[model samples]
Target: MEVLQMEVLQMMTPIEFWRAGFVFWTRAAEAQLEFASRWICAVGLSQRAAQTAAQKATIEALRAASVVPLAPNAISTPVPKRAARKAPRLAASRCRPTAH
Candidate 1:
């Protein structure tokens, strides 16, 4: 079982590993947000204040997990527009008319 698990892990690409890390930290951040919300609400904080506090706590957790929040003007390059998708070509047999 351990060898199987190791083999599976070894098969994971770098992007897959990064995605796994991202999902793990995203959940952790969400849990932090919930905790902050409950704590602030228990303290009789205003709704807006509670939200702000929760957001800050979530950001801190994300930062600790190495997920850096980017500013609006932090992007160095303009994002390129996605190219239009092309329809798949039909197989010759499928395209041909069948005899009745």
Candidate 2:
């Protein structure tokens, strides 16, 4: 058991460990949400209605889980404007056609 633990620790960096754990938890949460949605539908709710309810439930779940939903004004940084450059012109006499 100790040997196995050491091997596992050696296999992943801290970032990788956290990323893997996050992915696992996210997927588990999503599965739970899907199950809840399916259950709602099974309880005689119309498919479209169930889907709408599920979407609201998902938003609430994500908010409770501390996952911030994207909004229109979410960008914190202003985009930098690029300096315009003149396009290079090639001499027609120097241009050569290659046979494909």
Candidate 3:
């Protein structure tokens, strides 16, 4: 990126506008705008959105994913039961227990 910028600066003859860096700067500006929009949305403009169409859609999607409902009323099919745990019985009376 630095090499491209240097090449662009070298090509600027001071008689005309440099075209190459213009493209690069435009893309960088667009990226900064997107980053700022995301930060604003995250900081709660999502609920008070009086902005772009894309921002409104993003807020709606956020709200939809946030809503949660409690326990299910019924199971469509029965779940299989797990096997019972076996007791860990030991014949330890035949030997002395270890001193912990």
lDDT of 3: 0.53
Q: TM-score: which candidate is best?
A: 1
Error of 2 at 47 (Å): 2.3
TM-score of each: 0.63, 0.46, 0.32
Report the lDDT tens digits of candidate 2 across residue range 52-92. 77766666655556545544333434667899999987799
Off by over 4 Å in 1: 69-100
lDDT tens readout by residue for model 1, 2-55? 999899889999899888889999998998898889999999999899999898
Task: Give stretches of model 2 more than 4 Å off.
Answer: 56-100
Q: How far is candidate 2 from the true structure (C-alpha RMSD, Å)?
A: 12.4
Cα lDDT computed for each candidate against the true fold:
0.84, 0.73, 0.53
- Candidate 2: global Cα-lDDT? 0.73
Model 1 global lDDT (CA atoms, 0 to 1) = 0.84
**Model 3 TM-score, all chains together:** 0.32
